[model samples]
Target: MAWGPQSTPDYRFGRSKNTQRYSAPPGVTLLGYASPEGAGDAIHHYLRDHEAQVRRGQQVVRAVQQLINQGITPDITVTHPAWGEALFLKTLLPKAHHIQYCEFYYQNQGADIDFDPEYPSSIDGHYRSLCRNATQLLSLTQTDACISPTQWQCSRYPIEYQHKIKVVHEGVNTLFLTHKHWPTKSLRCSIILLILLTWAKRHAKRLLNASTSKPLPYPSGLI
Candidate 1:
């Protein structure tokens, strides 16, 4: 069971393309969210009213609940930290193992604070506060497993939660990089062909000039 942004092409390219191809073990089931209307509108509606968003999230969790209600217990359910707050898997998924893939905790802890200069201070402050609250909620949760791509990210969690955190290095495939050399070879071939064409053009021009300047051959009968 995986929760977070739904699996789309962009997210697939960003997050899982290489790993899925190279590192993922056989028989791994990648469960992702699917909304009837799609995730964009749902996320937009979620951001507007957090309380309503929490309710809606609970409804989403209930769908998972139905699977468990039918006695199908998944081995692991990985969720993004953003969706962690809305999902109460401890209560909802008591038997199944819950894991969270920690990304960033949104707050003003020395991170850049670039915003629209035209916006009033009050609006900025409200937005900042909302971000802080979301981060706070993410940090407070307890789960069976937590994984981070880097050690630095794993350190961001609370000391108690750190024991549960595991550092898994994301894998990379060199196949694409190797395939890139073929294009470079192709480019070099193209350059060489262009140079040869230029030389041929010059040679043809010289032959044409030489032929035009040379004396014409006389007819043997007239001579």
Candidate 2:
């Protein structure tokens, strides 16, 4: 879904590449910005995170504006709000339908903050976690709809926004997720796996993974 949108049925995505120089694929266009550090994000403060997101949103706005200037206006846009790209989008393209790729939402309790028995959530910690969600809430408010990977995750958003979220699995890797039978001796042992869904809980809420970092361009509506 990252690179599937196009007027010509081609896939294109873009973002900051390694400083060592890079090359794009045969049919892909690199329509992104090379942010200073952590895509202009910092882990030191919550306000900085929102600023970083705004910076990214500015990059996206410039890219889209350029496209419009060239007679290519997008009818639909998909973005990840964890980094703040979606914050200023609706103002620029109010007519374009925006869809946010919903993921993990941060909360003081009933979530990962207190999931660990070793570290209990504190008032300060809760406040920080809540602060982390500022950009997400703003993005959610402006977005026309949302899509999450699972029902449980989709339910993480505020009750008023739940109606706009849709459950759409990106699909699992059958090669690693296929069912298999284990011997009785092997079953005796316990296996605990920890999966990090989004960077909200990590990096002080300044998400910097490929999913959030790379903002691709699409040609038109829901294509």
Candidate 3:
């Protein structure tokens, strides 16, 4: 967890800097690094988030190095590409099968940002939004393959790289739903949009109806 809540300083990335091995899950190891102060706070700089990810990756590299020192090398490495800890991972584990999750790719205009006049997107904002996808693009080259949740979502990626992404939706487990068993947690995973007042007013009415309606009967998870 190089750049998430776990990696925040004064948090799970404790001063101990020790590798966390979970016994309950038996041999499940988790490595966390302290994210640099103000690492993700800036949006004006195009490389701002990417640079932060590289800094966090350095710490992860050191942690993995310790394992390498012990002659412990993994045959596979599952990572979140957006976290930036994956920056130098291929260099470190050249032979490992690396898999990254492919969520929605961002764009400055026509997609999420600059879609409405009420909420104007500045040139800097557009640049930042477009530039934020740098890490994802680099990951496309570095990773062995990718996993996407939906065909429509997978289609959002570049045409050439779409082949690398396999759609694996987390469909509701019907048996589990029938049994009323539900998992307590789901790890990280959204869309952004701008609104015109006319559409917003119509959407609000529909939203109210949706909100008042009963929640979905099924949750995503193991069957």
Candidate 4:
């Protein structure tokens, strides 16, 4: 089942069987109450940020409860914990094994904070980032297992949760990886060369990190 915005056609078309999509309630406000601004409002802003997540989490919990009452019990529930939907699932379905997709963890340095000097960091950015991770931390605690698309992504999580995360690629699009009959030989060769180059870089990075104390290189934000 998919639980997200109804505006996306993919979910509407892909929804099958008794699976359902539980989206946000109408006119609930995008991020809870009105957001606070300016330096003086930093603390207040972060409070609202967390409040928004809790509100969304409540909605998810209610939706799941309704589904459970309908006899639609699942043995395994796969969810992305980024938005707090997976927070209270374990409370309702203690017997069900929950596997959360660990997408990204916010960091103040060397990762998505001051990546570009042009876009300088905000004064309360660090605090906001930490508050943003509250939902993730809660969801991870409730989840039985976790999966990360890359090793680097898994490493971004807390040391406690890191042990539970398994690194696994979701798989690539074969159509994009392989050439079609329409493409010329030269184009196909170039594409293959690009792919090989990317693989070589990743391989080199793995070796370098393994031999040194430095960690595997990851993008400033989500890898």
Candidate 5:
């Protein structure tokens, strides 16, 4: 069951059959403090924007509480903590195992914010980035486990938190990558050669028996 913003998924994008959303009251703005004028203003805007996150967290907490009141307790809770939805879930469900998706950890200097030479980050920009990471940092501390899609991404987080984070690929679409019904005979000779090279290397024992010294049927030059 999804607990998020109250809106129907556009079929153009696709939709989940089951979702439980908690929308903010009308007129509430999404939390954002990206572009601030000065450090002081940055802090002020950051705090103001965070208030919205707090509200969202409260909404989710209330929803979870209601679910518990109705005798529904999830065994495991998975969440993408990049936003604040996972903020207070542990508080409500102490026994549940929470696995947070650690998509990114913002670093002002060595990361994306400053990588663009033409658009160097300003002092205020750096402050805003730090503020943006506040919720994610808090969520990390609360999560029972964290999954990062790559080692490079997991490395971006603090050393202390790395122990709780595991590097695991979200996975690729095998249907698109390997499930296509392509005719091996119809494939170009070059394409066929590449596949055979991989197949021979993987199945060397089967390809190279005591009867032959060579492991592959194709010429070494082609491979």
Candidate 6:
């Protein structure tokens, strides 16, 4: 069974709303929660109420346990950020393989500078601590695989976890790239060419209409 953060109705960044619409692989079931829009508020709330975080985590764990209790033995349990930490702590799926998506790091790295404006230092610290905890837990757990979009993030993980981590570079959907060989052209290049062609056609039509508006003066014999 598939156990992970299913998509919600909201248009949250990096998460698609149609996540649950699709069917899962055989013997797999998708799980999800009604999540808030941004991490900032959630992080702030968790910091102020540590017990609340634990309670929230417990709820998630119970949900997964319920699935297992119902004879749905999922082959894998996948998770992101906070949910991943909660699942790791609960150890509910001792038999199932654990897979996590390493989305980002909260440390004071250069990349975090812009984000600091939205997530203050306090929130950043809390997030970092949580991430570190999650990383350690994942390291100890017998997870089958760790998926990451970037090689840099794959490198940030501990050497032990690194071995299990796989770098699956994100790619466009095959359906969208109908031209099998067009992958050679970057998405930006395709978009630019389309825009240029559209503009040229539009302007060419305008020019044609303008020229036709008035019969060319003179040229008596040229119809």
The prediction achieving the highest TM-score against the true structure is 2
CA lDDT, every model vs. true structure: 0.48, 0.67, 0.63, 0.61, 0.61, 0.49
Name the top lDDT candidate.
2
Candidate 4 wrong stretches, greater than 4 Å: 1-43, 173-182, 186-223
Q: Candidate 1, which ten residues in sequence have the lowest lDDT sum? A: 8-17
lDDT of 4 by residue, 67-176 (tens): 55866555666777776567777887788778888878877766656644645678798888777788788888898888998877788888998989999877676767
lDDT, candidate 1, at 89: 58
lDDT of 2 by residue, 114-136 (tens): 76554677887888888888889
TM-score of each: 0.48, 0.70, 0.64, 0.61, 0.59, 0.49
Worst 10 residues of 2 by lDDT: 214-223
On residues 194-213, what C-alpha lDDT tens digit does candidate 3 reach at each position?
32322346346554554446
How many angstroms is residue 180 displaced in model 5 relative to the true structure, after the best TM-score fit? 9.4
Global CA lDDT computed for model 3: 0.63
Query: Which is the better candidate, 3 or 6, if ranked by TM-score?
Result: 3
lDDT of 5: 0.61
| Lowest lDDT 10-residue stretch of candidate 6 | 7-16
- Count clashing residue pairs in model 6: 3
Q: Write the per-residue lDDT of candidate 1 for residues 1-223, one digit (tens) a residue.
A: 4432323111111122324444333444333333222235545432533443354456546656665586654445556655433356566656656677765444333222223243223556557545544533542474677787777666755576778778985644466547555553322222211212212353555434544565535322110
Give per-residue lDDT, candidate 4, residue 157: 89
Tens digits of lDDT, candidate 6, 1-223: 2443343111111112444566545544345543323334546543433434444455556555566586655555555643333344326666666666765543444333233343345655656555444433533354567788768767765576678778987755677768765566434322222212112453555445555678655343121
Q: Give the poorly placed runs of model 1, Cα more than 4 Å off.
A: 2-49, 84-86, 112-140, 158-160, 171-223
Error of 5 at 191 (Å): 18
